[model samples]
Every structure is written in structure tokens, then in C-alpha cells.
Target: MIFLAIATCSGSAFAYRPFDGTDAAVAEPGELEVELQPAGVQQEQGTRTLIAPWTVLNFGLSEEWEAVFEGRGETPLVPSGPTELMMGGAFLKHVVVPGSLQGKDGPSVATEFGVLLPDSTGDSGVGASWAGIVSQRWDWGTIHFNAETALTRDHHADVFVGTIIEGPSKWKVRPVAEFFYEKEFGLEETVSGLVGLIWQVSDKLSFDVAFRHALTNRHPVNEVRAGLTFAVPLRFEGAHNR
Candidate 1:
């Protein structure tokens, strides 16, 4: 079964959406973005529902450099032996576009490369993961394309491609959509889409709300996600004089 919902509100362009899930679409250097997501679902075999909380933080180091940290762990409604914990990974991104790219009128393009450290419970000691991103921005919206490859301990390589779109709106009410494809893994080959909104409060602060639903269920654990995101700006003073 497929489900969908839409919510509209009056405000700025940054008011309604999840800004931290997609690393490639985060803010530029010297900026800070944060997200918190709480989701609930019922497993195929389990009669009781489960709730999980996820958090993400992104920081811009320089015009061409950024860092991301994420974590997720959930306690089952019913007490299990140990609450399952999903180890999130930490990664760094380097932008390949010139400073002039930000001032362009039409669709501006940028490239990014990132590395994911081994930090998962299922594959805690897995090898490093790599990803590449291409992003384009226009007056009406922004598009982000990302390709990621993971090297596991068993020498298996998994690859995935994801795309996200943010529509232009006043009062931060931007709608979002995403699709993903993966190969060479048990959880291989699935596509998903989401619609949500963003609210921009000030130049340095913003809030986001989003809804995510899977179009297909390749595994037994398909889910729908509702999340909230927050972004805080980090400013450095008097760096030009040094």
C-alpha cells in the first residue's frame, strides 16, 4: 500500500523541511545545520509498533569544506534483550566549485566528494565508503544528485544513487522529493519518494518538517517517516584581516 499527505502554511522559504538527511544538499561553508527525526512503524512479524529517533548535524568548515555527524538508536515498545542501535557514520565533504558559483544568476553547479567512516552495528568494522555529488540551483528550486559506494569486509561493493528536489516557495514552504537505487546488497534495489516543507526564520536559523514514504518494498522492513530539522548559523569574525 502507498500513502501520501500534503501540508501548507504561510511564512518564509526555510520554514518546512528536513535539511540534514541529504548531505550533498546541506548549507555552504561557515554555516551550521541540525535535524531531529522521530519515526514509528510496525514490523511485518511483530504485532507491536516501534519508534525510533534519529539526529543529524552538519557544519561548514570553509568555502570548500564541510563535516557531518549522524546517529540513530531506538528502543522497542516491548523490552527486547538489548535496544537495537543503528550506528551512524561521520563524513567530510569538499566542494569543487569556485566562489563565483554562488553569485550566478541561472542554474549554478557544484561537485562534492565525501568519505564515510565505518560506524555501523551490522558492519561495525567495514571498510571506508565513498560518495560523489552534483548539485544545481535555480531561482525556482534546487536539485541534488548523489552516488555512493560502500566497501564491506567481505569484499562486496554496494552502490546507490539518490536525487532530491526542493521547490521554491515563500514562507519557507519548500516541497521535497527523493528517489534511490541500490545494488549488490541484500537490501538491494529500492526506490523511494518524499514530500515536505521548510521554514526560514532568520538569516541564521530555520526549521524543517518532512514526510517520507517508500514506493516499493524490497525488504520486509519498509517504512514511512515524519521528521523535523533545525539549522543554526556559525559565524567567524575578523578572518579576512588575518
Candidate 2:
């Protein structure tokens, strides 16, 4: 059980649970979504695993704006023992361009800005994080680009750039893939790739499974993960009695 209490994912991915990525949209006002992913990996010499659950809470601040809240708990299997980490944050998202079901030409554009709070050591981990997210969506697929820079208590800095991609979504099952790269201020670079699928059971429930392989020999090893995502819309009861 290994966990990385990294970014607080925005509320837009259900078919993209395997990759640590987000979409360019936010939940409707008063809508809540939760995702649980339990995945691991196998390598030449050892294995790595993680069980983490994150919740996305969104409230429509306006017609085109949403306030987002995300929180997650992770328990990772490490060489010493199982370590627990908690991460959460609040974010704001604006849908600059909206995509429609029939619209296939233009891309939906959105931006997210947030701060990350993590419970970990200052030496190898982050004390705080400042992140900016940009996403684009077309008829064929979607792309999420992330740039994150963290502040460490010990005067160290780390930065990450992640690119997340998913294929066409007009089917019961859709293909999802990702390529992620990270570089610490003074450390070597690490790169990873993943391929997976998103199974849509219905509009409200879905499942995702993915396998990650290391492009660089230094980090990530190999991993297999699966998760479920569901959304529940908040509604007010109406009086039906005559």
C-alpha cells in the first residue's frame, strides 16, 4: 500500500480515474462526486500499491463559475511500513468555453487554480503547493495540462508537469491514457506512461482500470489500479400531494 498525497483532482474525470489527472469542467452547483481507486504495480524486483479515496464537491457560484473542494486519504506501502497521508484543498474553475453533445468542432476550455496542503515531511515531500491547471476538450477526446510548483519548508523546490489524455467518449467503454513527467529543482527527471479504460455503467456510475509503466528507470516501477466513480445531484423535494 503506497500512496502519493499529491494534487487535489478537480471534479471532471470518471472515465479517467487511472491517470492522476482532471478535466476542464466542474460539477453543477450543489453536485457531489466521489471516487475510490485501489491500484498497484509489479516490477522486476518488487511491487508498489496504494488505496486512496477522494471526494469532489462543487457548488455553482454563478452560471459559468464553480467553487471546488477536494479531499483525499492515502495509505501507501513503503519499505519501512504503511504510511498514511492526507491531502485536500479548495479550487476555482471557470468554463471559458462550453462543449455541447452535438458540437464537434470547437474545444471546451477551462482553467483551475488551487493550493495544496499535505501532511508529510519537508525534506522529500511538500509543505505546500501552488498549482495551475488548463484543460481542452474536443469531439474526439480531452487533454489536461498541469503545472505545479511546491514550497518546501527546508528551502527546497520541486515542479511537475503532467499531460493527461483520453480518447473518444461516445461509447460504453472509452480508452484513456496519460504521460506524466516530474522534476525536482535539483534532482533528476522522472517520466511515466499509462494506458487504461473507462467503463460507463450509466450516467451516474462508472469504473476505470489502468496499468502504468515507467518510461524512465528511476521512478514509478510499474502499477495496476482500478477505481469507481459516482455522482449524485442535489435536488429539492417537491410537494406532490394534491
Candidate 3:
């Protein structure tokens, strides 16, 4: 069997568990949310890539702003190669037109921008990216749309568009699906789909599992992912006085 440790891996800064797209929402001020994947597997062309314990940290900067950090550790299952740290980045997300996602009326809107860091191997270079998100919730379900562009590690321009659909929010356990198309200018194009389930255990915690299949330039890639997300509140005693 093949093993991998990559979490919600994507070309941009905002892809979260079970989905390659993110909602138009930000954490509440002084709150922290952690997204973790203990193990994930991806297989392509008779080779397997294993990344263990992918992680993303989100910290609330204000009512409408958040700070994000993402990274991962990749290792060969047989130790054929040295372990490396990859997919590192720092980002900022802002809620622009808060509506349904923020408990208001219409669709919520947000944007994220960041710099992508190089991995330990240095085969990739530093790059930049930005994404826009829109989300709407109905009595039956919720939908999120995302559009993003990035200057890749190889210095190529990459563009991605994705959509996510989730079952009724009232359900403790809900079915989720994501579909996306991405293109790396002068390179390959990818079409991908994912199906998954999310269990909302409590107000502050959730778990998810998903399976994804993608066709890149007619080559197939398959992946399995499982992870959890939890929130914590941060307190600053004298913050109001500042």
C-alpha cells in the first residue's frame, strides 16, 4: 500500500479539509483554529508520495481579518530519500462583503493573498498568490466558489477555479463534494473532483475524510485524506486599552 502525509494540498493558500476551496469566512477576533492531517496518500504513475502531518494554523487578527500559516513534512516510505519540509506559506485573509457566511443576508465575499515559501530541496522558488471566495447558505445546503492565481515555484503562472457543496448545516454529519479545474500556463491542465464527509463533533471541533481523483494532462492521480479542525480562543488582557 502507498502512504502520504499531505493535508488539503492545493496550489493556493486557502484550501481546507475535504475541499480544494474555502468559504468566505474568517475566524472571530482572538480565536485560533488548527487544521491537521495525520496521514495522507497520493499515487501517480506507479510512484507514491507520502507526507505526514500536514498542518495549517489560522489566527484571528480582527473581526474581518485572519492570518494563516501552512506547511508539511514529506518522507519516502522506504527511506530511499531524505525527508524534507515543503508547502510553507504565510497568508492574510479578509472578509469583504459579509453576508450569509457571517450570519447576514446575501452571499459572503472574501479574499486571501500570500507569499509561498520554498521547500528544503530548493527545487522550487518563492512565489506569490491570491484568491477570491464567495459563499452562500440556504436551508438545504451551502456552496462556496473560489478563483485563484499564483506564481508557482517554477515561476509559471497558475490559475485555479473550484466549487464546494455541503449538506445542510443542521446535520451533525454531512456529505461534501468539491470540483475544480486548474491550469499552469505553458504547462499542464488538471481537472479534479473529491467526495467526502465531515462530522461536526462540537462547536469547536470537526473531523473529515475524503477521496480525490484528478486527471492532469490525461495522467491520473488518486488521493485519500483525513483530518480534524479545532478552534481555541486567545486572550489579551490589555488589548482593549491599546
Candidate 4:
């Protein structure tokens, strides 16, 4: 009876993947990044699909800082149910060190803080979350790790630990994989893993599709997700600014 309650997207054109865990970098000052998921599915006793669409909008405010907005509208695959908007989130991310996008460098680090806003003021609820990230560029590919904690409106706390290893980018399509574990206070723990691909269509556009399966019985059997991400330059401090 576990659910794929939360999902995320991040910068890969600038140095991360859409479906992978977040990287230790933020959008450059004056840059804009958007991710759109056209289709996503989760299966438990039966198939539960998300058709209302999911989106993430990121705006660069400074060289090492970015403002983010994420929202997902849910329409469970029932023929007669109306779509109910889920909680939306707003976050601020700061990069402590700008890591190399490519190379065998040490790593980049960042921190993020955010709040979840309920779709309505009808006492639905809210949540707060924070995360720390570490990422490194390797000869073979890139690696990223995230440690996150959240306090939902119900006052329950949850923790997530995730990591991603993306394949080399010499080709138009790159393979990526990740493993994640989550622990919910007063609830059963769950472990899951993902395998996906990043299709770099251009400097500003990328597409991704991924399959996630639960490693523990506390979650849905599997999930299928496909999305597209695009980066638009608002303004740049310099030529090297992405």
C-alpha cells in the first residue's frame, strides 16, 4: 500500500539529470530551467497513473543561488474522478562550491530549504524540507548524493538518502542509475532503485524516461516516468556561466 508520493527533477544540461537525484549545483544567475513530465505511472494492486502533469520551474537569482517552484496536479486513472491539485513547493538552493561540470574533480556541495504549500486554504496542510547535496565529476561519468529530511503538515518526519551515477555524455543518449532509501517516522521503511536515460537533444533541451522498482515490500511494485527538461538563458554574468 505504499505510494510514489514525491518525485523530483534537476539540472543535467547544466550538469545533472531530470529524473536523477539533485546535483550540488544551482542554475546560474539569470538562467531559467523548466521540466515537464508528460506521463508517469505507478503500480500497486492495480495501475495508478498521474495524468494531470508535473512541472518544476527554476530561476537563477545569483551566481550560486537559485529560486525554485514545483507543482504536481494529480488525476488518478479513474474514469469518474476529478483531478485534485496536490501540494506545491517553493525552494531556494545555494551552491557552496561550483563544481566542474566535466572532469575528475573532487566534488561540488550545496544546501536547499523549502516549504510545501497545500493546494487550498481549506486546512489541507503544509510541509517543510531541507537537503544537502554532494556531487563529483569523474572520467567515466558523474556521481551525486543527497540527504534530505521533511516535516509534513501532519507533523510526521521523513528522511531520504539517494545517489545517482550518470553515464558518459559522448553520445546523444546517456544511461543513468540510482538507488534510494526512505524512512518514515511511525511507518515502514522502503528501498527503491531507478534506471533511466538522458537524451541530450541540444544545449537547451533534454528528454528522460525512467523505471523505478521497490526493493522492499513497503512500496508500489514499480513506476514508469517520462519527462522533458529545457534550460533558457535569461542573462549571463559571463560566457562560461551556464
Query: Number of the top candidate by lDDT?
Result: 3
In candidate 1 the C-alpha lDDT for residue 15 amounts to 14
Give one digit per residue, the lDDT tens place, for model 1 in 130-224: 66666666668777776767664344676767777777634466667766665647644545555666666665555555555443344443444
In TM-score terms, which candidate is top?
3
Q: List model 2 lDDT by residue over 1-242, tens digit each.
A: 21232343322221236665556566666666555654343452354435454445566666557766655444445543454444445567777777542143455556665555544433333245555556666668777776666544333576767788777776789888887776555645668788999998997789988887764446447767777777776654453342
**Clash pairs detected, candidate 3:** 4-40, 4-50, 4-51, 5-51, 5-52
Model 3 residue 182 CA deviation in Å: 0.8
Sorted on lDDT, best first, the list reads 3, 4, 2, 1
Off by over 4 Å in 1: 1-31, 38-51, 78-81, 98-101, 105-123, 153-155, 169-171, 215-217, 220-222, 233-242
Model 4's alpha-carbon lDDT is 0.69
Give a tens-digit lDDT track for model 4, residues 1-242. 00122332221111144443588877766888877776677665564756436677778898788887765556667343555556656788888876765232568888888876665324647778888888887667878888888875455787888898898766689898888777768855778788999899997799998888874456466778788889888865685675
Give the distance in Å from residue 64's predicted Cα in candidate 2 to where it truly belongs.
Answer: 3.1
Residue 126's C-alpha lDDT in candidate 3?
82
Q: In angstroms, what RMSD does candidate 1 have relative to the true structure?
A: 8.4
Cα RMSDs of all predictions? 8.4, 5.0, 3.9, 5.9
Superposition error at 140 for model 3 (Å): 0.6
Q: What is the C-alpha lDDT of each candidate?
A: 0.50, 0.58, 0.83, 0.69
> How do all models score by TM-score?
0.69, 0.72, 0.91, 0.83
Higher-scoring candidate on TM-score, 2 or 4: 4
lDDT of 2 at 213: 78
